[model samples]
Target: MLGQDPDAAQELMHSWAAQLSTRAQAAAELSDRVATIASSAVGANGAVRVTVGASGALTDLRLDDRVQRIPGAELAITIMAAIARAQAGLTEQVSIAVHDTVGTDSETGRAITDTFARRFPKPADEQPDRSERDARDGW
Candidate 1:
């Protein structure tokens, strides 16, 4: 018992709950985006691999099942999206498969782009400010 006021404890719990809900919603959306991106990658049996370090860096990334020679733009977009998701505290793995072979790598590129668009969507006009939170909430 920290001997804090009971009302203060209730406020702390409420703030904690609100913060957790916000994070959970963001993470869920990011997960859905990951799945969409992974399923849309253009390659033969493609997979989007992501690795994150404890410090939250884009530790490692791979696409199309380790195959290289894909367009640099495509790879960059995919890697960037994975990094974004990781930086947002989402999980570190996403996979997508492009079933069409007409363009192969190019199609995969398109798929990756589409996934990025869907995942990143337009940013909200307004965002919550962490500085406004109560100190007892502790994020």
Candidate 2:
């Protein structure tokens, strides 16, 4: 068949190469987007704000003047809670990035999402319950 219809096989190979290139581009785009992702959370009636990067590392923490009213130990707890809450959001943010870039149904998408979910799972207690969010929102 090589001599009978060589063009057919060449065309098929071209199509496969093109598909592979497209997928590689999509995966690179997804990686770029995920790398730039940052998630944040507020706690303690807006006294504390925490931001975490794609790796679930604390990139920023903000404490309002109201933090002065909170006891030292309590403020520590609030900040820690906010950090966990922020980390928990990393999975959601990555999922959105993955969906937008590669689609969640893809193997790459599922792997990336599952890794993030496992690394930054919602804190054991899912810190910052309804009351904490309400306070942060001034409710």
Candidate 3:
């Protein structure tokens, strides 16, 4: 008959429990930091305002009465731009949280930042090509 070592088994159980506790603490801290994330932006002379949550989801939007003076298309563009800016700000906050928790060089940190970068790309100044328009118009 083989006999089991009680002391060794007890030590192993304690080690596992400690590891689990440490992981739980880290997860809790990350959750708290993420919950604190909120970003906002104002657009077009404060005619439009936008706020985004930690995951870049829009949480709130406000339009000033002056927005009525702008054309519909222009107002739409301004609102969209504001939302994009707010999303970008949220991504920045998430990047900081990831860096603080997992280190920027770690695989987890890299994946998080990469995801945000791909999802919320930097805004660019885009205009229709004048040459194409002229050709189409036969000017």
Candidate 4:
């Protein structure tokens, strides 16, 4: 279906991705705001780290150290999901690491891991074949 109407598909996908990114950015902002929850809980003692970057067709998310204690995983998952949901082209890859300032619980890791794993699946049309279009359309 797309080979016969490549331009149309590309345009549709582009528009869809743009909308998704915009929404993801909005959601990122919200999640980032809440990301301080865990760090704040530890007051002056704890810190949270979050990094989000583009990795091919997926978004690479890393949350580590003291940040994992609060809402680090939740925030990371939120941002990842937002990006994956908003951008149809994105597949999510979220990684988390935590250090114990107080103590560690097995459930914490499981919870965050589960959250990342259980996020909603991406839609099929989100991953458009852009290679041919890039060569032909000069996009």
Best by TM-score: 2
Candidate 3 per-residue lDDT, tens place, 1-139, comes to 1138888888888999997787567656766887888989887666678898877788899987877776787677777877777877777887888777756776666777788778876567622233334467995
lDDT of each: 0.45, 0.86, 0.74, 0.39
Candidate 4, poorest ten consecutive residues by summed lDDT: 37-46
Candidate 1 lDDT tens digits, 24-137: 665565445544332211221234556554334555666553446435665555555545555433222322222122122554445544554555443333222222232336
lDDT of 1 at 74: 56
Judge candidate 3 against the unseen true structure and give its global Cα lDDT, from 0 to 1: 0.74
Q: Which whole-number lDDT from 0 to 100 does residue 54 have in model 2?
A: 84
As for TM-score, the candidate ahead, 2 or 3, is: 2
Better of 1 and 2 by lDDT: 2
Q: How many pairs of residues collide in model 2?
A: 0
Give Cα distance to truth, residue 32, candidate 4, Å: 9.9
Clashing pairs in 3: none
What does candidate 2 score on TM? 0.85
lDDT of 3 at 64: 78
Off by over 4 Å in 1: 38-139
Candidate 4's displacement at residue 35, Å, is: 1.1
Residue 7 lDDT, candidate 2, scale 0-100: 95
Q: Could you give candidate 4's per-residue lDDT for residues 1-139 as a string of tens digits?
A: 7778989899999999997786566446434432432210111122322233322233233434544444555545444443455332211222223112111244433454346445534444432222333456885
